[model samples]
Target: MSKIWGRILWPLAGFGSFVLVWYLVAVSGVMPPGQLPRPDEVVGTLATQFRDDDLLLDVRLSVLRVLIGVAVGCSLALPVGFLLAWYTPLRQMFDPLFSFFRALPPIALIPLVIIYLGIGEQARLFILIYAAFFASVVVIYEGIASTDEIYVRAARSMGASEMELFRRVIVPLAVPQVLVAVRVAVGVCWATLVAAELIAAQRGLGASIQDAANFFQIEMVYGGVVLIGLSALVMDRLLAVVMKRAVRWQDRVGG
Candidate 1:
């Protein structure tokens, strides 16, 4: 009971402290008026948007884009990452290219994507795919590469074939690390999402934010920002749950 209450109380306490500090800062006259809105103002804006302005719809659209981007990117990236890790020649050939691409931010490719794909869902997806792919590939590759050599040696000594070694050994070791990559890529996707929507969005939290900023609606901006953070947190938590389930056998592995 104490542990449960601790889990519940600690997060609430931290949140309450953050809000209290924010409120103090807002009332302190440090920032310009109407810029850093107080907690109440943000809540009011949230209520108004949900009641009359379709903020929930915008949030849903933004979330959908992120989901699609991460899903598609992961689908393609994991296998490629594993291949790169498993094949020395291929890893040597592609490592430099992967590094170069990873250095390029998704937003920096916006103009090229727009020119090639046009400013539509394709462009948004392109940016998201870029963000998730590059962020995840290296992590996944490294995870596979870093797997315990003892496992490989033992499997080989037992007469395990290459495919058997991979299936019985490397995959179980890499899944957790790959999921870590997914968590990081989810953050990358969310970070790039607004830029994707900025291409020409009719609906999305990013579009709502742009509209709010255009009209100097500070509270609404804060509301949109808060929603993005919350959404990212939720997605990350879901990934954590998946990771926990997928790696449940770790404790049983001796050595």
Candidate 2:
């Protein structure tokens, strides 16, 4: 616990310093209010524009989309990655397609997705899946490929069947990397949602920012930006906690 606190304190201190700098910059009058609202002003606008009910609703909506997208992406990617790693011919078949699509930015697909799916939740979900799939598949595939060959060989020597070797040896070895991949996917997937929302429809932090921009609500815009950053930080930290617990055996071995 002390160690965790120590780790957290460092980032907290850095964040505090950042906030101080932002406040100084805003108060120094180097920029016009229209350009950069003061932190306090942004906070005030956040309170005024955000009713208690809708604030939570907006947060929930964005989080729900992120969860759904990441879930679908991981569901597909993990199995696909494992199969590709286990079967060379399968890997050869899909590797080029994966590489091509992974290289394409999720934002680049938004227009086409919107045209096909229209301005609906599906469009947003599509971008999220694209973002999460590419990122997770790369990590998962690498993880599987890098799974210690010694373990697989040892398992075979012990007369373990192929399925048993995969389940008991390979998966256990690859799980640490899979967890890390999920962490990376969380960020990528959420970011893609922002771009997806910007192009299309109705509600979301991205849409909120766009609306604020159109109305010249500079403080609201800043508030939205700040909220998004804070949300991501919180989610990452929560995932870190989960990761630490999930990978405790690995840590113990290293320790």
Candidate 3:
């Protein structure tokens, strides 16, 4: 029982302390009245918005966007990264280009995406895919490339075919890293989501925030931002559960 409470409070301790301080500061009036609202004010705003502002619909749409983005990004990136790592010649030819593309911010591609895909679901999904693809590719390629040479040699000495070697050996060894990549991809997708929705989305957390800020509705802005953050937190925890399940075969998870 004590252990259970400890586990529950362990993560909340930092956030709870921070909120306490914020509440005190907000009430103490170091900043101007409109600068930062009280914590309760923000809570009230959240409650009111959820009750009448179609916040649930916005959340559903945003979640759907993330799901689609993650699926597309993982599907394309996993194969490319695995193949590149296995085939050094291809990696050599593409690494420089890959680096260049990855270094570019996903938002930087928004203009081109708008021109090509227009300001619609495609544009938003493009941003998410662009952000997650490079992230996953880098992680997966590194994971596969760093595979132990001894294992490779042993597998090859047994006359293991390339497909067998990859499918049976490399893939299992790389599952943990791939799962980590999935986590990173999810975060990247969420981070880029707001920027994607800000462009032409009629309804989304990002759109709500943009609208709130335009009218100087600080409470509304904070509420939307908090919703985005909390949503990410929940999804990340869900991913953590998935990671635990996927890596159950390993005695200990390695980087």
Question: Can you give the lDDT of residue 128 in candidate 3?
Answer: 88
TM-score rank order: 1, 3, 2
Candidate 1 residue 206 C-alpha distance from true site, Å: 0.8
Q: Tens digit of lDDT per residue, candidate 1, span 1-255?
A: 887666678878988999999999999999988779999999998999999987889999999999988888887899999999999899999999999999998888988988999988888888998899999999999889878899999999999999999998998888787888889889999998889898998889989989889999989989999999999988998887788788878873221
Show the colliding residue pairs in model 3.
Answer: none
Model 3 error, position 23 (Å)? 0.9
Cα RMSDs, all models: 2.4, 2.2, 1.7
User: How high a TM-score does candidate 1 get?
Assistant: 0.95
TM-score, per-candidate, Cα-based: 0.95, 0.92, 0.94
lDDT of 1: 0.89
lDDT of 3: 0.87
Worst lDDT 10-window in candidate 3: 2-11
Per-residue lDDT tens digits for candidate 2, residues 1-255, read 887767878778898898889889988989975687777898888887676526656667778888888888888899988988888888888889999998899988877887898877888888898898898998898778877788889999999999999889888888777777787888997777679777665778888888889999888788888877778778878888887877788863221
**Backbone clashes in model 1, listed as residue pairs:** none
**Candidate No. with top lDDT:** 1
lDDT for each of the candidates?
Answer: 0.89, 0.81, 0.87
Candidate 3: tens digits of C-alpha lDDT, residues 24-92:
999998989897987889999988888998788888899888878888898899999998999999999
